[model samples]
Target: MNYMDDFPMLNKDIVYFDNGATTLKPKSVIKAMDDYYLNYSSNAHRGDYKISLKVNDAYEGVREKVKKLINAKSSNEIVFTSGSTDSLNMIVYGYFKNKLNKDDEVLVTKSEHASNILPWYELSNEMGININYIPLTENHTVTLDNVIKSITPKTKVISIAHVTNVIGDVRPIKEIIEYAHKNNILVVIDGAQSVGHIKVDVQDMDIDFLAFSAHKMLGPTGVGVLYGKYDLLNELIPTRYGGGMNISFTSKDEIEYKELPYKLEAGTQNIAGVIGLGAAIDYINNVGINNIEETCDSLKEYIISGLKSIPHIKVYNENVEGSIVTFNVKDVFAQDTAIYLDKYNICVRSGSHCAKKLEDELGIKNTCRISIYFYNTKEDADKLINALKNENILEESLGV
Candidate 1:
């Protein structure tokens, strides 16, 4: 099924293959945000006025929507933040800082995004915790056997991305989480690339903490979610302390904070973005997540099959699951390939893709990534292939 009509960006005469970065917002998501700004513009959960109450309802409604989207135990477990980076920071400092000890260890893969790995790096430096990598297979994907061999008695946390942004390898999270739990370790999932493309059931997977962005999943920018189990999330201290989260404050030493989700949501939120996120979730549910995954899976296969015929294009993640296809055009620098593709009105991402440590595993520092979404088509792949087939690619991209 064609989703061209739903996204206004499709009319711009460009092939959008940078879905891993951010997706084009659907009309429904746009309309929802517009309606919030145009119809009822007021501070939520403040003032007893009618519009304020309406704003309160709409803002809080998105929390429930997110809870259902991931099948969390309660809406109380959902905490809204700026984006995945913000959410990961909160999870690392707000929750783990106090719980973890100096000698404790945290396990992560080199392929994780900066959002997932850097925070742990900061925490490790500050708290004297050891950070270790779970060895990846030859395909640059994680295996359950490797996870077992990496863990030690001091391994208190296992944090990794559900689907790596660069290699597009979907980790064996369920098996990893189960093993971690048996060893009394907590599992934190960076779901920025996984939540939108695949079905995420927090309960079934027994995830301890999950972070994701709204913009990557067809919602507005400046909004994201941090999902934690009730007891665990309740223990997380508020990273940002401000109004809308406190019940009472006497002197410097006396203050009363609210419960569960509200305690974490300090200060005024991105109300319009939250409402748009609700609409995006609605749009995905209407189209069915399974259908979206199927479309990407099939399109990825078709594109990989065609790319193999081109000698210069060295495709990475060909055997990996999900929609992302990583490659480089032999002697051409990744960024030059990107610039050349832009001339053809086809867009693709080229770089370390915020996974700088990934170079250790992939054996290359830079690559061009074609991350597909449900909205991309076979025609888009054809255009990319045709452009790569040109022998003058190096000279043309270099403007020589």
Candidate 2:
């Protein structure tokens, strides 16, 4: 079956360019979730009943799927969380609570999404660790030189986004990871915007920890993967504790915890969501991530060229090689531009996009961002540009 054809929202006339925020799910994913609720909707890893066993197996299968998706060393390294935000927080709080001390530093960049930055900031505040910013170049890409200069003996962790959500600049994670590891610093990557859009090999990159949301890859929301090195994960403690993650409990003394992934995942998981994520991974594997990347690259090129041809428009990070295009048109407010484009059945994201610090660093209040996925085509790009060209006329006539 054609994967794009299975998306319910694609049948509508609206052009979807806000894929960075979330993606529309395919029918297979929906069917997978439906099958769970209809047939074997039981709590996972808690009961030995047949339905519960089936749920447990299906839920655990997703761990293997995610490990393969990112080329992780083992399925035991993958932990399920609510989403990227939860995963990042878990790692930050769990690791830093024991690892960092007063005057110790956590290095990050100005281009990070709030999900990656805020958790580290809060950790630093509570633990008395110093948060240091790795400065970006004029083109908005982080350089190894800046990273090298920022690192001091006190730096214990280097947390960064694999790709900037606002500018779409991909980070040099391999180089950064190698550099950090040489200095005995741990690297945590926020992969929320990078995982589905490009090929990611956590083992090859030697990333200590990484987090990505499944919904961004056309899976269900409230489901995400956190991949950590086996040895490192074995050493860290769980930020969340409850059923399904513990080994044994004593009334008077300490409780032993389960190993690796189970130790990190507490309570009842979103079994249906995990099953749907496995299906989504199957769909992506069939389509091929390289093919998806190339398709979006072509669409991004088309969008950047078209937007540049329009008068009084400034595209952010024009040279960056990613599927997103962020820009501001003339004197129009980013929200106003998005509102005007809505009349043409065009959908785009506007405002700070949860990267307020990055926006402030760039000295822009807001921008309109058009993020494309593999299913998008040149026709969508044309519609966006045409609508943008006629935005003023549409706005004036509508008395806006």
Candidate 3:
């Protein structure tokens, strides 16, 4: 598929390998948002006019699309939020905070993004719960053995990323979820990196809670989804309160809150972002998620092989499978390598990548990450390889 025509940014003179941060927006998603603003710019559930009615339909319609995207049980299972960070915060503070007692443990990994870790950290401090780590294998990948070993009698919840943003290793989520269920533990999956690149079926996995951002999957920013089972999700207290989430309220302690998702979402909401997310789902369905994953895997293998052939290039996570390749130019700082690559019109991410503790596992604090999407071609790989092959990379990066 010719994705260059669809993504406006691709036509520019640059190779983007930062999909883990966010994917490029497709034209269809942009057009949908534009149409929403130009045609029906009305607040949802607040008016009975024609455009407002249309806004409600488009807004709620995206909920159904999200439900089908993840094979969720019902549309009510999806609650829109600001982003994956907001969704995870809701899961941690809104639900788990009230459920866990003092000294209860929640399992997470070092490779998890900060959004997944920090919320749990705050919850642990407030509730006196222990935050535990699921040991990663020598390859920095989680195994069922490690998960089993990490779970103790006090372990009430297992919170982890379906795919680690730092290493891009796809965790054995199904096996882990199955084992956790057997031990009567609820699982919270951070699907920010996985949902956009791979197939995720909440029903098949029996996931307790799932969170992901639309921007990472070719949709606009400021829109995300928090998916939970109907019964468990309803148990979550509304972290925020306002209009559109209640039916009636009075000074005499007479307040009736809405149910399920509406109870969780209590504001004007991001109407344009929601419509764009629906369009993004439509685009993904047309291209096929499996096809996108396969393309990324093939490209990743090729890129890794090319980088490995360069003597000065040290590739990390080379054995790990996924759309990301982490490496460093020997004797050059990670950010310096990123700056040098920018000289060649290539884009890559550097630094700790929001997984600060991953340094304990890697024994290195920083590495350049190349997170690919389906749109990236082998030519992008060639450009990056050639740039690494050039002489005086250290001096050039140092501006000497």
Query: Comparing candidate 1 with candidate 2, which one achieves the higher lDDT?
Result: 1
Question: How does each model score on lDDT?
Answer: 0.93, 0.87, 0.93
TM-score-better candidate, 1 vs 2: 1
TM-score for each candidate, following the candidate numbering: 0.99, 0.97, 0.99
- For model 2, the stretches where C-alpha displacement exceeds 4 angstroms are 1-4, 391-400
Put down candidate 2 lDDT per residue, 76-189, tens digits, no spaces.
Answer: 999998899988988888876787889999999877888988887887778788999998888888888989999999999999989878888888999988999999999999
lDDT of 3 by residue, 174-254 (tens): 999999999999999999999968999999989999999999999999999999999999999999999889888896599
lDDT measured at residue 344 in model 1 versus the true structure, 0 to 100:
94
Candidate 1 structure, TM-score to reference: 0.99
Q: Native-vs-model 2 lDDT?
A: 0.87
Candidate 1 displacement at residue 150 in angstroms: 0.4
Candidate 1, lDDT over the whole model: 0.93
Question: TM-score of predicted model 2?
Answer: 0.97
Single out the weakest 10-residue window by summed lDDT for candidate 1: 1-10
